[model samples]
Target: MAATAAVAVACGAPAEEPAPEAPHGYVAGAEETAEVQSRLVVADAAGAVRVLDLATEEVVEAGRVDGVGSVTGDGRHAYLASDDGSVRIVDSGSWTVDHGDHTHYYRAAVREVGSVPGADPVAVHADQAVTALALADGTVALLDRARLDEGAVVELATIPRTPHRGPAVPYEGHVLASVAEPGQQFGSGVAVHDRAGAPVATIDEPCPALEGAAVTRRGVVFGCADGALLVSGSDGAFAGEKIPYPQAVTADERVREFRHRPGSALLTARAGEAGIWALDVTARTWTRHDTGPVAAVNSAGAGTALLTLTADGVLHALDPASGAELAATPLLTAPVAPGVRIEVDTSRAYVNDPAAGVIHEIDYADALRVARTFDLGGTPSRMVETGR
Candidate 1:
């Protein structure tokens, strides 16, 4: 049976008098300068890209784009991709249409591409104008960022049957994707693609049904179905380790969701359990954090983690090292489950609550509070932050 909890805060308390509307979106932290401006761009399931100023907690500008499969940004521009095989570029400064400026806005589309049912756009390279994996059609395609208007999205290459439902990570000019097959049964691996879109190598020995993967400045880390973790050095050397699956945790107790800490370790939440596990790759150890049946988990940075409890729509901030709660704030009211996805940066977090048809925002620095929410018009399946 599902658990129940009491709601503590009123649902509609008028927000502390709204801050001045930001120029781009919502600005959260300190004053915005040429170098340090609070900016975030998110893509919803309905194929729209919304830019927010983290400082002001407001939507700066929103526009329709074809299948915004994923999003990423440098410090100045946000890159968006579509599962239908297209890419849209938006200027972070003005939050307006700049598709004509290839240097700033690069657009591309793939024709006759079948559906990528459970995939998302994971990585982007602004300098090279290349966008990486996350497609449900069991393939990963890399397209040209410059001549996107050529009508035909040039397919640099494709990776097949990679069931990874997480973001693709780009490291040292190459893109890495996790491949896990359905039923959590077998045949999972990691596919490494070069800049030219060629599969250079595939690592399948350690685990299959690999659900999450992240690349750091030094190597790549991935999580498997049966509580296994794998790491590959920057030089392509592979290492495998297993995380103890709590005996008290049943088969129904699966790793509900997880996030990789770029260069450190992995944070995972198990269903039916009221805690999050921090797996240290180097030490080959697991430290469990009691947080109550987490609906979601996201790593904002090295030592900071976010835990979402679906029952009351509350999000908790944790210090992975000490298993201590740093802050807590309530978000959505509806029950969020497996399909609800979240993405975060150091200052803010974004959640795609399909049932609510809106993307909820949480301010990490401010008591892990829910600052604002936006309607997506349809069930949003995934979310990612781009351009800082």
Candidate 2:
């Protein structure tokens, strides 16, 4: 461990004095003014957080938590949800704050900035304004991320605990949460609320069993049994529009789980036993593909292609438009049980071989072959790669 550094940026004003002249400490591997970058955050079964540098493919930092749920990132930091019902904001220590003339690159310890309470951590806005927390009891807490950056955990609103398993999305001053139809297991509607937790509107647009959710540049979308729910607008005037599945695509075998990086316009999900669906956010469309019982997935390219891993340790790249199999790479050396998973972004695809205590990195644009492999020497139960 090293000493920590703190730097905050308040835009829209020129510096009162010229930026401080200083001797540099730990500099980021990439320049702040360069294109955006991200690092991987891995949470092991022993309740420890291990970070692997995306470039080096080596563990760089380690920390501890109660348990790992969803980990959300905003380029500058990561907010991780634990089994203990706490959300700890970990400084990714690799970020850039843009100013007019120059950008400030930063490197800090993998430290906890602040936290809030909820059984699970959900969405983090693209600009890092707020974070949403969800619980199995169907409660959602929207916390202010800007306050967390100021070393505060301010809860903006908490939707009462309902009887459904759903997550919430936060816009400027409003939140959208999925709700189940009365006495039904599927969530066919969404409840909208203001910052004060006051109900604004309830949208019933027929997206049965809403489960998978992703926030895109276009808007926030949720997966449904019949189709997807696309939410547009901002602040108090948010609108929910239903994008129904084409009549050619039936709902009986639709996927309820979608995996994607928050703020990514593209989303990928699994359909039934061996089906894959690529969602295009810009046009609000769904394209079907197959990955043969995919266990876990992370997608990119706005529904262009998908990097997927089946339950049997085989990784496949499929053409999102035509359900064509592009490539396949066997990921594991030894057979393991079901539940191993893969996470992919624009740069690389990370696959965890839990049975071998290893994580494999593949060049997605190349032949889908292993570029690097990490021998962790221990199994990592839950993992999330940060860097878009």
Candidate 3:
């Protein structure tokens, strides 16, 4: 953890100086004091996870896991799903491994039993059980969180062969999953499962490949190929509304990622030529904001979104409701050649420059200003904030 430093220049300085270049590696103790503290966890391309303190702008802790995938947090514990068939847990408070030995803090080993090839863990249910899909073997398995340290995950249930990638949202009491063929133009479907992990219903329609899925307070929203969006209710009934993209948009122009702002009625993302689109489920309308080639998008509190540009490494905070630019800051002075991934909380944002193996902290309250930076030993792929 590094302490903050205030750079000074004479008011009557004769010449203007260029901003300092971002340092590389783990530069410790550079902390920032802000009104609110937000945590950002980021994974670099090399599959390592780093936990950052947004308010202090410091790299509190760092850990490496193989094949890191999706990250989810309950505002207390940060869960990292790995492709090595395990889930790693971290106490967000101390930025240390959760379980024990700091090494095996929160680890659950899930073996591929019954001839089914192992799949990367996707979504964690509301109750914390994890859902994973075996694409090659066409199997879906649910693992209980309580039995994580027993060297084997307690298998909850399984679904037969289906082509789908899932964060399978667990809504009300049922878990939802999707199935779609990559090359197929249409004809995809979703499945609903009871709390016991038994299939209750299946929905098949002309949906594109599922890109992102989220369970909102109101309903379930799933992103599809060809800019098709679907919403379902808690009763496993369709909402009778399909949000179709503009006629100019094609299947090739599909949404890659989505993040639902807590307590918001809108979902924001980087969509095709439409750039950052704000889809209002309540209003049943879509508004696009022109953000040039968005490299990453993250939630910035309720009804707000953070968009990052790959070319310049500039971050823009937007109002999800009106698509307005709330604040902007330059995280990286130069272009992040390999690109960077961002993780945001209501109070702060963390930017990972993998090329430099450094994590930059930006203070959201100060209009996304660079608060501090950290250098880590290994490249980070994803990050989450766990409050211990």
lDDT for every model?
Answer: 0.54, 0.67, 0.55
lDDT of 3 by residue, 204-271 (tens): 55455666665554566777765545656555554424677654555545665665544345666776
Name the candidate that leads on lDDT: 2
Error of 2 at 98 (Å): 9.6
- Which regions of candidate 2 fall more than 4 Å away from where they truly are? 1-33, 56-58, 66-81, 84-89, 95-107, 114-127, 150-152, 181-186, 234-236, 247-252, 333-339
Residue 114's lDDT within candidate 1 is: 23
Error of 2 at 142 (Å): 2.0
RMSD of 3: 18.0
List, residue by residue over 1-388, the lDDT tens digit for candidate 1: 1222223344445568877676652233322344334455655666665665655555644566665545555444455666555555555442112233322321121112122233345444332355555554455666554333222345565556544454455554666666555644333666666767567776555554555554433345555656655545456444444555544554445453456422335455554565666666555566666666677776765556645455567777777778677877767665664446566655667776666777777777777677777763555554545434
- Residue 90, model 3: lDDT of 50
**Clashes in model 2: which pairs?**
none
Q: Tell me the number of clashing residue pairs for each predicted model.
A: 22, 0, 27
TM-score of each: 0.61, 0.79, 0.68
